[model samples]
Target: MPKIALHNRDGSSNGTVDLDDAVFDVAVNVPAMHQVVTAQLAAARSGTSKTKSRGEVRGGGKKPWRQKGTGRARQGSIRSPQWSGGGIAHGPSGEQNHVKRVNKKLKRVALRSALSDRARSGDVRVVDDLVFEAPRTKDALAFLDALEIGSRRVLVVMAARDQVTGRSFRNLRRVHLLTVDQLNTYDVLVSDVVIFQRAALDHIGKGSRPDLGQRGRRPSAGTRSDDADLGQRGRRPSAGSRSDDADLVLTGREQE
Candidate 1:
């Protein structure tokens, strides 16, 4: 398992946390990451560019000249493709689809590969929590200063409920804030460093891989053995072994 130092909001060393092997220790897949990133960028295109075709252009109804009288290559219409103001022959039709379909498994692999690459490079940081009293850009800047994250593009992943942190970080030009649900390969790869709140990291480890059978649930103390065994066997832990609604219980115990 990959272990990273956990820090407090003021950048003091608290302890360390073991990252999920499935999410942050996978072998990096460059090709898969490239493909997924390409698809993601392609999907963002609006594909709304359209050019009028020859048939759709106005003033094409009346033929400019008779078949052979004009001796001008038998003029068809003023708006013919050969004319100066002619419509485009083969151009974008506004309905063109630029979206590329990538397999869900490939996307997951790419994301994990990106995160693993960052982890290996020591660009991943985990913070215990970010409980801001209010949204203040000054406090956000101080937080970054404390973390020594000077000017470098940083990706901050926080829980959805932590809107205060989101707002606090939004004013920093170099800081990109995203909820855990919005985390993806492109954003992770583009950032110089990635900071994850402890709760968000736990949620990602448990929920990102649906195949692990740990979605929306925390592994109870009793299921640690099963998790280890599944990790060794390259399979999912038994569903019966996980305890639903255990997040609050586990969080309180861990904090204590």
Candidate 2:
């Protein structure tokens, strides 16, 4: 099981808590995380972009000119697509659907993957509690600063309702206040650090995967290189079979 220490508001360790292995110990699936984040963003789109078609534009009702020569071409309606002030061609209908369907199982898996990635990188922090005497942004800001995350991007996950905390952190430009139920793969992956209230663990489903043990392992050196230097042509060539990258580029060109 993956475990993390619970910390006080002053950033002192209170105790340690074991995380649900299913939610925080799975192997990171980069592709799954990417796809889930993409889907979550897609679902947020309103897809309401609309345009007037040629037929919908104003003042295109009557033919501008008759056929056969007043030094003009034959006309149907002045609103035709070929004319100025015409409706759009193949434009949006204001009914486009941007929602993407990710199955419940896959969503859970992706969530686990993202959380695991963060946990593996030692970025998930647990706080024993975050109650406020009353709603105040300064307190929240001070709390985050004490945690060493005030200047960094943070995602705070709370279990119980705390409207005051929500209001306080919501205004912070670098902070995202989210309830346990509202937690998803996208936010988990995007934030530089994730702070979870101790009770928030209960909200994470108990579906631990024991097969994926330790992670954050790097790939073989033979396969590792900066992508910007080589593009997507895969791993670097071995020493014995080494050829100039320019030659490889030429080979690709020749194949094309």
Candidate 3:
């Protein structure tokens, strides 16, 4: 474990902070990092691809001509894959899967490796705490300035869920927030520096933390889940639900 001096709002020494050496001090493993990142990115892609073969084509139910044509070549249905306006012949459609599996432990190791590399380079910033009187953008900016981390891409690792803190930084470019356990290689590699509130280190590790309430009030109509459920259950059925009856009536009229 390594200790770093956290600074106060006025640029004074706030306190000392210790980091998890296993995550921040391990030797850099470039190969492992690359593999993990590539694998994760690959896993995120949707493999929804398919192709319509000749057999799946429409409007090709009957043969166009007999096997022995009169002076002309034998023919099949016009909608056959071999003919114009026909379905594709083994051409790729859009319904295949393209997911790759990777070991979870290996992914964790790669994340730790990336964190260690960043830590070794002095790119990790540990802050005493980000206490804001209110959820103001200026207050957040001031904190960033106090730590001399302004103007750089930042990933703020918080100890607990702070909706105000998250929302305040939403409009800012190159700033992100993640809880400790939620830390991943994508975020760690994308940012130039990682900032964590002092208490966040322990809170983000393994247990549940308090959710910082939202700054603004929410709409009253959809405020709670139970209310939404009740409203949905109270609604009447629609005309679409009688589609079967309508179809039966239409068929009866045709028969008559």
Candidate 4:
């Protein structure tokens, strides 16, 4: 089990929380993360890059000269690919399908791998719920300053909707705020620090040390239930958690 120092919005340490080993103690899967991130970013691409083929170009209906008598060379339409102003050959079409698919189960594993890496690198932090009486950019800035990430890029995970919190952080270009459901490997890997609201841990499971609450441990390897074999083999179930696996991982997502 791993633990992080919990802090108040004002820069003071409140206590500590345990992180779920399943979520933040697993080995980093670079290949899996790369695959998922690449797919996710591909989905965002408009894939609108386009070029006209020779057949599609205008004014190609007329042949420049008689092919048999042409002195320079045999000629077809002026719009042929060999010509200076001719349509492109083997160029990009606007209809390309850039999307790639990643398995839901593999995506989760990759996400956990990324989060675990962050934990190991000492970039994961926990904070009291970020609630704002009203949305204020200054307050958001101040809040981040308190966390000592005033100018650092950060990923904040909220357990639930908090419009005020969203508004406050929205003004900070470097701070990305997302609900627990929106949490993904791309954001977690790109940011300098990953912060989670105390309540948000419930959604992702604090996986904290037992003293914090439930013994958030997976069944020991020594203990095998009869139904264990019935579940999917070779995949760590999200433990019946939300199916928020990413369609892609972090390979090219940083283009934004």
Which of the numbered candidates is closest to the native, going by highest lDDT?
1
Q: Report the lDDT tens digits of candidate 1 across residue range 172-246.
A: 656766556556777678789999989878777655322323332221222222221111122222221122212
By lDDT, is 1 or 4 better? Answer: 1
Any residue pairs clashing in model 4, and if so which?
18-208, 19-207, 20-207, 36-248, 36-249, 37-248, 37-249, 37-250, 40-248
Residues 38-154 of candidate 4 have per-residue lDDT tens digits of 766665566679999998888878878887855778778999999988999999999887767776777877788888898999888898868888889898788888888757678
Positional deviation of residue 32's Cα in model 1 after best superposition, in angstroms: 0.7
- Give model 1's TM-score versus the native structure: 0.73
lDDT of 2 by residue, 1-256 (tens): 7778889987898988887665677778888767766766665556788998987888877777777779777888877777777878889999998767765555656667878788889989999888777778789888988788747778787764566676666556577665555556766666789998877664453321112122111222234323211211232122111111111111111221
Ranking by lDDT: 1, 4, 2, 3
Q: List ranges where model 3 is wrong by over 4 Å.
A: 9-11, 48-92, 203-256
- lDDT tens readout by residue for model 3, 1-256: 6877786654568777766665567677788768766655554444545656667766777887777847777777777677878768777667554444555555556666777777888888877766555667677777778778858888877665556666665555566665444456755776799887777665533233334332111112222213210111111111111111111111111211
Q: Cα miss at 65, model 4 (Å)?
A: 3.6
Report the number of backbone clashes for model 3: 13
Residue-pair clashes per candidate? 0, 3, 13, 9
lDDT of each: 0.67, 0.62, 0.57, 0.66
- Model 4 regions more than 4 Å off: 68-71, 206-243, 246-256
Model 1 lDDT vs. the true structure?
Answer: 0.67
